[model samples]
Target: MIGATGFIGLNVVDALQARGVSVRATWRKKSITVFAQKRNPEWCLAELDDTVALEEAMRGCDVVFFAGGHYPRYSLDRRASIERGRADVRAVCTAAMHADVPRVVYTSSIGTLDGSVAGPVNADDRTVDPPRESVYRATKWAMEEEVDFALARGLDVVTVLPGACLGPWDVRLGTTGVLVALLNGALPWWVDGIVNVADVRDVAAVHVAAAEVAPRGARYAFGGVTTTMRALFEDLARRWGVRFPPEELDVAAAYIRADVEEAAAAPRRGRVPMPRELVDLVAWGRRVDSSRAALELGVVARDRETTLEDARQWLERMGHVPRRAEATAVRSRNSAESTRGASAHAGSRKR
Candidate 1:
C-alpha cells in the first residue's frame, strides 16, 4: 500500500489486512502517519518523486500497488501539474520494471475517462492524450499514458478508475470534504452537475479482485450509484438537519470561483474553500456503468444511504465534523458489505 496514509489507501489497507493479505505499506518521509500507527502492516519509507527509493521499496515484492500517484493538491499550474504527474508515474512504472515485479495494480480516477453527456460511460470511453478540460483531467490522463508505455514493455498492469469515493477514514477529507463542508456551513453555493459515487470499501475490494482475477490491462470503473449534485446536497441537508445553500451556481460561475479560491490557497498550501478538482469532477462527471466489476469480481455495493451514514459517523467521531450532528450520525458498522475469501492472496503486494 504505497499511500497507506491517504483516504482510499488507508481503507484499502484495512480491507486487505482483514483478508489476511500481507502488505508492505510505504509512506513518504514528509507525510503525517499518525493514523497508520494503529494499523500493523510492515512500513517502508519511500518517496514518489525519488525513483531510486521507490525501486528499493519495490525490491522482492510480487506486486506493487501504485496507489500514491502524483495527484496535485491544487490545479493552478497546468503545465507543471501535467509534467509532475507524468514524471511521477513514469518513475513508478520504471521502478516496477526494474524490480522485476510481476504485476502492478494502479489506482486512477474516472476523470481520465471520456465522460459521456448522452448516457452512462464505461471503460471503453478513453480520454484524449491531452484532455480538453481542467488540469486535474490532463494530469490523470498523462499519468495513465505512462502506464500504457509500461504495458508495451511487457509489464502486467491493471488500472482501476474509481469515481468519487466516500466512506470512513477520510483524514484529509479529500472527496468527503464536500460532505464536511456542507455540514459545517462552509459551502457558500452548490453546483448543479452529475455526481457518480461508490463506497470506498467496495472500491478497495475491486482492487484486491483485480490483482487476484482481473485480466492484465483490464480497467474497471467502480461507481455503482449516480445522482445529481442538487439532489445529493438536498438529501444530505434533509437527513443531517442542515440548511441547504439558497444559491445554485452555473458551471461557468463555479469554475471561476474555484479558480479564484485555488489561487488564494496555493500560497499557504492549505485547503481551498472550493477545490478545483471537485469542480472539474462534477462538471465533467458522467453516470458510469460498473457492471463489469460486479460480473467479474462479484462485488455489489451496499446501500448508498448506509455508505453515507458510515462516512458521516466516522467524521463525527474524529471531530472533523462538529459534535452537533452526532445524534443522527453514528450507526452500526455491521452493515452489508461485499466479501471475498483470502484463498487467492499469494505473494505480498507493496502499496
Candidate 2:
C-alpha cells in the first residue's frame, strides 16, 4: 500500500491484517511514528513520487493499491499543487506497472462522479459531464485515466471510487478528519451539505475484494448511507453529550460564491477564504449506491448510525476534543461583547 499511515490507509492496513494478510505499508518521514512504533512495524518510509523507493516497495507484491492523494478542501496553491497531484498519480501507476504488480486498485473520489441528478447514484451512473467543482475532481479524473493507461498496457487494474468516507480511524484523514474539527469546535457552523458516507473498514474490504473479483478496467462505487448536515451534527452532539441546534443553515450558495471570489482574489499560499464550491458540496451531498461492490466484491456497507457512533468514540479516544474548549471560549467572548453593546445603547437612551 502506498499510503499506509493515513486515516483510510491505516484502517485498510488493520483490516487487511485482520484477514491474515501480511502488509508492507509505506509512508513519509513525518508519519513514521504512527506506524513504526506500532506493534506490527512492517511500515516502510517512502514518498509517493519517489519512483525508486516506490518500486522497491511494490517489488514482488501481488497487488498494488494507490490510496495516496492530497485533499483540495481549502484554497491551496492550485497551479502548483494540482499539477503535482496529477503527476503523482501518473508516476505511481506507471511505477506499479513497471514493477509487474499483477493487480492494481486505485482509490478515487465520488466528487469526480456526477451527482447533479436526484436520487441514488450507482457505480454505473455516468460521471459528471464537464466542469468539475474543484481541482480535486480534475486530478482524480486524470488519475483514473492513468489507471486506464496501465490497463491498456495489459495490467490487471480496477478503480474504486468512494464517496465521503467516514468511520472510526479518521485521526489523520483529510475529509473525514473534518469530523474531529467540528466536534472540537474548530468549525463554528456546519456547512450546508448532505454527505454520502462509507465506513472506512468497508472501503478497505472492497479494495481487497476487488483485487480478485472486480473485472479488469471496471470502476466500482464504494459508499454506504447518506445524511444531511444537520443529521450528522446532531448525531455527533448526541454521542458527545452536547447540545446541537437544529436550525436550518442554508449557506451553500454563499459559500460557493465566496470560494470562487476567494480563489480569484487571494494570492497563492495565502489564507483563502473557504470556497463556495465546498459549501455547495456539503449542501447538495448526493446519495451513492454500493450494490455493485456488495454483489461483485462481497463488500457490504455498515449502517450509517454505526459509522457515526464509531467515529465519535474513536475521536474522543484520540484527544481531539480539546479544541471544543477553545470554541467555548470564543463563544463566551462574542456573547460578552454583545452584552456590552446592549448596555451602551441603554445608557445613550437614558441621556
Candidate 3:
C-alpha cells in the first residue's frame, strides 16, 4: 500500500491488518513509526516518483492500493500540485503494470466528479465542461485521466471516490480541520453550504473491500451522509453544549472574508488564513449517492450521529480539545439533557 502514512492510507493499512492480510506499506523519507509498531506491515521507503522503488514494493504483491496524492492546503502551488498528482498516478500504475499486479485500487476524490448538479452525485457523474478553475480539483481530475490512460494500457484498476472523510487517525487534521478550527475558535461564523461526509474508517473499509471484490475498471462513490454546514455545527453544539457562532455567511461574504484573512496572514505566516479552495468547497452544496458501493461492495456507513460522536471523542482523547473546555462541554450537555428529560416527564404526567 503506497501512502501508508497518510490519513486514509494508514486506516487502509489497519483495515487490511484487521482481516489478517499481509500488507507491504510504504513511507517516504519521514517514517511513521506508529504504522510499523501497530500494524507491523512490511515497510518500504519509497517516494512517489521513484518508479524503481515502487516496482520493488509491488513485486510479489497481488494487489496495490495507490492512495498517494498531493492535496495542498493554505498554499496554492498549481503547477507543482498538478505535476506531482499526474506523476504519482503514472509512476504507481506503471510500476503495478510492470510487476504484473492483478489488481490496483486507486483512491480518487469526489472532487473529480461534478457536484453542481441538483441531485445526488454518482460514479458516472462528470465534471463540468471546460472544468472549474481550482488547482486541487484540476489535479485530482488529471490523476483520474492518468488512471484512464493506464486502463487503456491493459492495467486492471478500480477507483474509490470518497467524500469529506472524518473520524480517527486524522493526525494531520486534513479533512477534519474545520472541526478543529471551530473548536479552537478560529472560525467565527459558519458558511452556508452542504457536504457529503464519511468516516475515515468506513472509507478505508470500502477501499479494502474494493480491492478484494470490486470488478476491474469499476468506480465507486461512497460517503456516509449529506449534511448542511449549519446542521453539522448545530449537532456539534448540541453534543458539546457550547454556544457556537450562530451567524451564517453567504458565499460572497465568505469569499471576501477569506481574501481579507489571506492578505493579513500571508505576510506573517506565509500561509493563508483560509484557502480559496476551502471557500469553494464550503460553497459546494451537492448530495452524493454511495448505494452502488453498498449494494455491490458491501460497503456500509455508520450512522451520521454515531460518526460525529466518535469524532468528538477521538478529538478529546487526542488532546485536541482542552481539558477545561471539555469539562464545560460535558457539564453543559448533561444539564441540557436533564432539563429536557424533566420537561418530557412533566408533560407526560399532565397529559
Candidate 4:
C-alpha cells in the first residue's frame, strides 16, 4: 500500500488488516515516524519518483493499493504541483507493472469528474476540463490519462474516486479542516455551497472491495450524501454546541476576501485564510451518484447523522475538541439562552 501514512491510506491499511490481509505499507522520510511504530505492518521507505525502490517495495505483494498523491494546500507553484502529481502516479504504476503486481486499486479525487451537468455525476460522466490556472484539477485529469495509458499496456487497475471524506484518523485534517476551524471559531463564516460527504471508513472499504472484485480498468465514484454548506455547518454547530455565522457569504464576497487575505499574507510567507480554489468550489458545488459502488461493490454508506456523530467522537478522542461533558454543558447553555430570548420576545409583544 503506497502512501500508507496518508489520511485515507492509513484507514485503508486498517481496513485491510481487519480483513486479515498482510499489507506492505510504504512511507516517505517525513512520514516514517507515523508508521514506524511497533504495531504497523512491514514498511518501505521510498520517494514517489524512485521507481527502483518502489519496485522493491512491491515485490511479493499480490495486490497494490496506490493511494499516493500530493495536494498542496498553500503553494501556488503550478508547474511544480503538476509535475509532482503526475510523477507520483506514474512511478507507482511503472513499479507495479515491473514487479508484476496482479491487481491495483488507485485512489483518485472526485474533482476529476464534471459536476456542471444537471444530474448527479456518475463514473460514465465526462470529467471537467479544468482551466489552465487550476493546477490541482488539471493534474488529476493528467493522472487519469496516465491511468488510461497504463490500462492499455495491460495493467490491472481499478480507480476509486472519493468525495469529501470525513470520519476518524484525519491526522492531516485535509477534508475536515473546515469543521475544525469552524468549531474553534477561527472561521466564523462559510460560503454558499453544496458538498457530497463520505466516511473515510466507507472509502477504505470501497478500495479494498474494488481491489478484490472490481473489473479491470473500471472506475467507481463514491459519495454518501449531498448537502448545502449551511446545512452541514448548522449540523456541526448543533452537535458540537457551537455557534456558526447566520449569513452565508456570496461568491463575489468570498473571492474578494480570499484575494485580500492572500495578498496580505504573501509578504509574511503565510498562506491565505481561505484559498481561491475553495471559493470557486463553493460557487460550483458537487453532486455525484455513487450507486455503482453500492450495487457492484456492495458499499453501504453510513447516514450523515451517524457519520457526523462519529466525527465528533473521533475529534474528541484525538484531543481536537473538549470532553463530552464540557460539550454537553455548552449545549445546555445555548439551549437556555435560546429559551430566555424567546420568553423576552413574547413579553415585549404582550406589553
Candidate topping TM-score:
1
Model 4 TM-score, all chains together: 0.87
Model 3 residue pairs with clashes: none
- Flag regions of model 1 displaced more than 4 Å: 324-351
Consecutive 10-residue window with the lowest summed lDDT within model 4: 31-40
lDDT string for model 3 (144-241, tens) is 99899999999999999998888877766776767766666566765767778898889998898898888989999986788887888788777665
lDDT of 2 by residue, 132-177 (tens): 4555565556666666676787888888888777777665544555
> How do all models score by TM-score?
0.90, 0.80, 0.86, 0.87
Candidate structures ordered by TM-score, highest first = 1, 4, 3, 2
Model 1 lDDT at residue 74: 91
Model 2: how far residue 113 lies from native, Å: 0.5
lDDT: which is higher, 2 or 3?
3
lDDT (10s digit) by residue, model 1, range 1-351? 788888878888888889888888888877769887688778888888777888888888877887788777798899999998888888888888888988999998888888654678887688556676789988998889999999999999999888888999888878888888887778887688888888999988888888889899999888768888888888998888776976788889988988888788889887864688888988986888888989998887788898889998898888877776343443222121211222223323321
Query: What is the number of backbone collisions in each predicted candidate, taken in the order shown?
Result: 2, 9, 0, 0
Arrange candidates by lDDT, descending: 1, 3, 4, 2
lDDT of 4: 0.78
Query: Which 10-residue span in candidate 3 carries the lowest summed lDDT?
Result: 269-278
